[model samples]
Target: MAKQKIRKGDLVQVIAGKDKGLQGKVIQSLPRDGKVIVEGVNRVKKHTKVGQTARGSQTGGIITTEAPIQVSNVMLVVEHEGKKVVTRVGFRREEQERTLPDGSKKTVTRSVRFAKKTGEAI
Candidate 1:
């Protein structure tokens, strides 16, 4: 599987659903599931149980929490053409460098180019 361009802390905007057009920072990302939980978005309430034996806790009430949204439902917010926009992957940069498995220099290169649209370090 390919790595994701969006990270846990990336700023993203919801592009679909009732939360469309809403923007927030990513709180968590599940690359395997291609879902991300944005802060203060997709809020859902969860029922809680109050136990008589509690440590300095008096009451238990409904807990509101953010739920994970599909990654496709959100777009990576990026600055392009002097405007903030959502973008896809572009060209990749070629660099002359390789990590050695045994702590030895195996290969060396010069420059690497990355996708300007997605800001991915390709």
Candidate 2:
């Protein structure tokens, strides 16, 4: 499996589906399923039977929440030139020097995500 680009708390815009053009923050990421739950998008109503909790408190009722949507349906939103815009994600590997416990500096390579539209780190 490839790495997941979209992450929790990332602002994204729905590019396809009934919620097209809607923007929201990603609440969760499901990399294995290639899905993400966005706040205020793909709202779903769930019905539940009345039940008692371990604390003896009421626990079930009609609930509304965001449902998972395919990661492809959304695009990451970034601010560009004082305007909000959607951009594709790109990964880049960079080398940096790190100091080891032995006081020796070592070069390490790390992957980073960046905005393809503006060529800027994200």
Please, what is the TM-score per model?
0.69, 0.90
Give model 2's clash tally: 0
lDDT per residue, candidate 2, 21-91, as tens digits?
Answer: 99999999999999999999999999999999899998878999889999999999999999998999999
**CA RMSD of each candidate after superposition:** 4.4, 1.5
Per lDDT, the best of the predicted structures is 2
Q: Which stretches of candidate 1 lie over 4 Å from their true place?
A: 52-54, 80-83, 96-122
Query: Against the true structure, whose TM-score is highest?
Result: 2
Candidate 1 lDDT, 1-122, residue by residue in tens: 76666778877889899899999999999999888999988999998787655466566679999999998898777666677776654445455656688877655545443446657553
Model 2, residue 53: C-alpha shift (Å): 1.3
